[model samples]
Target: MNLSTEVRRLRDMDWGELDIKESGGWPFLLQLICCVLVLGLTLAGTYWYLAAPKLEELGQARTEEARLIRDYQSKAAQAAHLEVMREEMAILEERMNTLRDMLPTGAEVPSLIDNISEAAISNQLSIEFIRLRSPVSQEFYVEQPFDIRVRGGYHRIAEFLANVASLPRIVTQHDLTLEPMEDAGGEQLQLSMLARTYSYRQSGEEEEAP
Candidate 1:
């Protein structure tokens, strides 16, 4: 049988017909693409408006917390070091007080003169002139010094100065003088010196405060 006659017979025999057409298919596909684009744009806009700022804020907060933690640690270390220094200072103060308590107090000039005389006698030297000057202010201490002249042989004068240097308190000699005695033997010489001494007071004792 012919194809059209067979199709007609099939339609008349209570069977359905299939109709195929190409019209308006492009419009339907265009509508579908538009829907997909709209959906993608909506999702991107939601993310930009709602989630991006929160993520940025979370990152900034984390950085701030880390900086605060580091600052706290540094301050804690500084406080600890300060405490240790305070303890060390207390110990030093105690030691200084003990030393000050043990030191002697008397007229410094008489003792120094007697010591000088003893050194001269032991070394077989004669003291010609000894002059002492009042102290000058040098910070918290005094710069009490003596200018001395003596006549003796070279070895004896050296022995006398050495004995003077051996005293317990600190002494420094300056402006040394040595010359041959004109009338005496060539071995005899004159010795002149400026000798210095120091004195100290206890901590917390002050001549002036501001």
Candidate 2:
């Protein structure tokens, strides 16, 4: 048997008579085709088992790396503004201190009446009476209000009000009234007004708020 005889036998082979169970007795071409098909299936199964998981892990690693890069960029941007943020916080604290200083303390609130009295006396006005009212509760601070009555000329009353405005602590006048003193002189009048000041709430006072 030579290569041509083999080729002639292959060409004359009957396709309908082939049996997979009798592979050993099959023609050379059929056996070779069967071996190639088996080799291809084995390689495909090996790749699925060995390489597919590694490829999936590589894809996950790339995704994690991208997420980490984005996180680092965001933090670096925040870090660049850190000094400016600190400076702004310091300025805000200083402003808050200045405002707190403008508000009086609980013990010092009583002396505020003396301040108003001094202002009236210095302005040549007779202090009729200065009385303290109940303290008012608010969300952030306590408001201390007082009532003041004085008798004086119009210019002296105006000067007393201006002096009250220039006090070290904050004060405001409200509900002002003036009337003639009835024959002491036409120039003499009585002035009545409510004045208010503020104070900072002490620690542990928030629980008492209603």
Candidate 3:
């Protein structure tokens, strides 16, 4: 039909006479609009029933894949550095063993005391006394203290300290006192001090002299 005739029929159509039974007589414009509405509703319902759920599942799968990739990369980096970590641990253990050797053993303590005595004599200091004090128990070791009294020139006392520091075993001096002897014309000095050494506390190790 001509466009003008269809336009006039749509405008003059009787709304009350429109019915499903007479749909063939309906205006072309109205039929076209009804067909477009039905098609749009069908497409919308199809997407809701089928495509929507699939799209949602696809999004969740992408997120899980990303998480798994990140986890794998982190574990791979740790595996790559595994050898370096082992070497570092070995170095740490070797250094620990060397430090343990620096601590004196029970049998060696007598020799260590004798060495200190020799150091005093070699520095021209007269030893008044060098006696062991009570040992202190610690978590990892024992503290062996000695009360040392001597008479010597000032420089000799200093030299004795230098010798103690250079000993193969570790010894430290604390609480030093120097007083001038009454009749030595200020040339002779009396020295009193606390000397400390350590013995490692290991199972089945002999206890050093108390």
TM-scores of the models, in the given order? 0.53, 0.60, 0.59
Clashing residue pairs in candidate 1, if any? Answer: none
lDDT to native, each model: 0.74, 0.88, 0.90
Better of 1 and 2 by lDDT: 2
lDDT of 3 by residue, 139-196 (tens): 6798989999989999999999899988988898899999999888899999999999
Error of 1 at 29 (Å): 24
Runs of candidate 2 with Cα error greater than 4 angstroms are 1-79, 206-210
Give the lowest summed-lDDT range of ten residues in model 2. Answer: 201-210
Model 1 poorest ten-residue lDDT run: 14-23
Residue-level lDDT tens digits of model 2 in 76-178: 9989999998999999999999989989987887777788888999989999899888888886889888899999999999999999998989899999999
Error of 2 at 123 (Å): 0.9
- Candidate 2's TM-score: 0.60
* lDDT digits (tens) for residues 99-125 of candidate 1: 554332335656877788888988988
| Superposition TM-score, candidate 3 onto the true structure | 0.59
